[model samples]
Target: MKRLKQIVNELKLTQAAPEAALMREFIFYSPKMPLRLHQEQLVAASKQFSLEVFDTYFAHSDVTINCFSWGNGKRKVLLAHGWASKALDFYELIIELLKIDDLEIIAFDAPGNGSSISEFSNLMLYAGSVKSIALNYAQPDVLIGHSLGGMANVIALQELEITPHLLISIAPLIRLKENFEQSLDSVNIGAKHQDLFFDNFAKEFPVSASHFNLTNLYQLSTAIDHFLAFDPADHISPYSFLKEFLDKYPAIKSKSFEDVGHYKILRSLEVIDDVVKRIYALPML
Candidate 1:
């Protein structure tokens, strides 16, 4: 059964590249199909949290960004969400950090995802979306990001010329190593064939996408949906998104974890607490 699954997955990859991109957009861009999180959980968790969520324009691009703060303070903490995810995705962790009376939390949805704009065509456009958001809320003592968000933050900081006192990245895509980079545009393993990735990993490698739940699958599907509009074939490989974005290399330092796919990396309470401690420990200026 496993061998047969692998064969089927490979065949799908071989056949899907040309049209898979279009099909992906059809699934993701519907106004009725926008991705959402558990609203009650987000709202109930945020009471007395001094939350201010709104949309603002940055460089004329409408950005959906939120600010959560407690008490008056000069310090600002900005949280960036991963690809295809919204600012609310960080609500759970943001609530935890809001307990600190002297701190502020802000998060934003990147372009082409969530309530933000729906049309961005390249890595620079994605990074610029971050820059536009950052300019509106630049009072940062620290910057936190997960996976694609982390990478975008790096690019945004450079583009906006904004610097935070501390930078923390969780499972960031600073580099993809060699094998994953090589596989990006491979005729047999391109990004367009991600629907078959689970089966491919299960049968070809020892990994199974089933280890994750429906939420994870939904987010992955969202990412595929957005990538479809970009016509990834025009670019070298999806790998170049990171390479091109990182060419200048911002000064922030970071730590990464394995075994945690992008979404799981942001869901860690440990990371949230660690970030709070680091921000609080910074010297008052």
Candidate 2:
């Protein structure tokens, strides 16, 4: 309250205006983690596997994206990193993929994430970046995504020129609108500013709030296998909500682990093994 009032007073702006400004700032970033602290990890991981870095133009902006690739197998596996994370964050997972004789691994950082350059980012921008990366690379035979990256890969299934043979989603965002609203509430903005913020949000995004979720957008062309791995105890992407969402589609194959949290699920050897096995299990397309 004090900081909000101070900003409002200093700028001679209404309380709602400052809250709206804050809402815009938070809405773009609340769901994603920042990667500055992980710089050393990215640097050291880049040294392994003789990574090949390339650039692509993100679909939503005039920004260049950093893409990573390794392995020399005929089958291409594309890895999409979540917001605020880079391609090398999956160093362990990449190591497992490298072991496969027939797999060529590909991964990329979305604009403003990792080595990619951009001033800011949003879900739509990230999704657009995913689409751009898929088309730039040879269409991937296997697609893997984590968190926001998982959601982006799902969106890729809809937007890509060709559908992948296998899709793996790890704790994707179930309903981004609900999460965004909760983020708004956390900032202690009153209802009026919230309304104003959303009104402008709709104008800027030009899409229904309901459209950004995983449920309504989740689909793959026939013959595509899907795997989902997530810890039900995850607080970031709540297990109960994921359960209800999963319950609606019983055919989807899933594995549950407890206490690994949202991000560590990526690092879990069990997850890496199962994911590798599934990729090998995928019928060559």
Candidate 3:
């Protein structure tokens, strides 16, 4: 990825049209890594307990979202997976949550992700898809999001009028600017294209980088319980980002794990147990 970015950066310096094309490719490309054999087994195991499983399509203005749901409990729990991943990434977590009575579990393949036909998607698109699902299907009592989905959920909360009973974010991407800068730096994109990148990005998305801050949308009056669990060793979504939120929202319950890292943290039995315990710990609402 770094080498590809470096090549794009050089092309940007040399020509205008090719540079724009390269930039578009960088912005729109979605990795298509399929679930591994073990992951497939986990997903298969999870499916065994589902009361009902079916596919549904949601048409948002420009994009069509394809997603699936498991269980039929009155109380809904929505799960959003991260980039380069499908809803099945949460198979283990879903499996554990299924043991809980009166809880419906829904997971979706976002546009440009998983089985969805869309070829590209940004944060705004992901957030919009989330909001559409919440409003059109069921307003989730418990909202669980991992990685990029976690960040999109934060943005979705801003637009969603319904306040969930609990919001659990696992290894969430917190700072947009920091992430963007790191991506640019990784590809050795210099000062000029860095400025150009943000400018072009702002034009493409509905929300600006300045408005993407989750802290601005979070409120104590929202009357929602929040739980954040992140592995301190996680490099993708740094522990420091979660720590920043912890410092700001003292009421937010959090647990830090040692060796879980980013992806494994989702599948960890210990983490799944912790999440289930947290959900059950909450008083009936």
- Candidate maximizing lDDT: 3
Clashing residue pairs, candidate 3? none
- Candidate 2, residues 25-128, lDDT tens digits: the string is 55553233445545445444542322222222223426666666676677888888776677777878987887788777877777667666665566665666
Each model's lDDT: 0.47, 0.70, 0.72
Lowest-sum lDDT 10-residue window in model 1: 221-230
lDDT of 1 by residue, 94-206 (tens): 77777766666666555555555544322334455556545544456677776556556666665556556676655444442232323333434455455544344445324
Q: By TM-score, rank the candidates, best first.
A: 3, 2, 1
Model 2 residue runs over 4 Å out of place are: 1-17, 29-61, 283-285
Candidate 3, which ten residues in sequence have the lowest lDDT sum? Answer: 49-58
1 or 2, greater by lDDT: 2
Model 3, stretches more than 4 Å misplaced? 1-18, 36-60, 220-222, 283-285
Model 2 root mean square deviation, Cα atoms: 5.3
**Which 10-residue span in candidate 2 carries the lowest summed lDDT?**
49-58
TM-score per model over all chains: 0.55, 0.81, 0.82
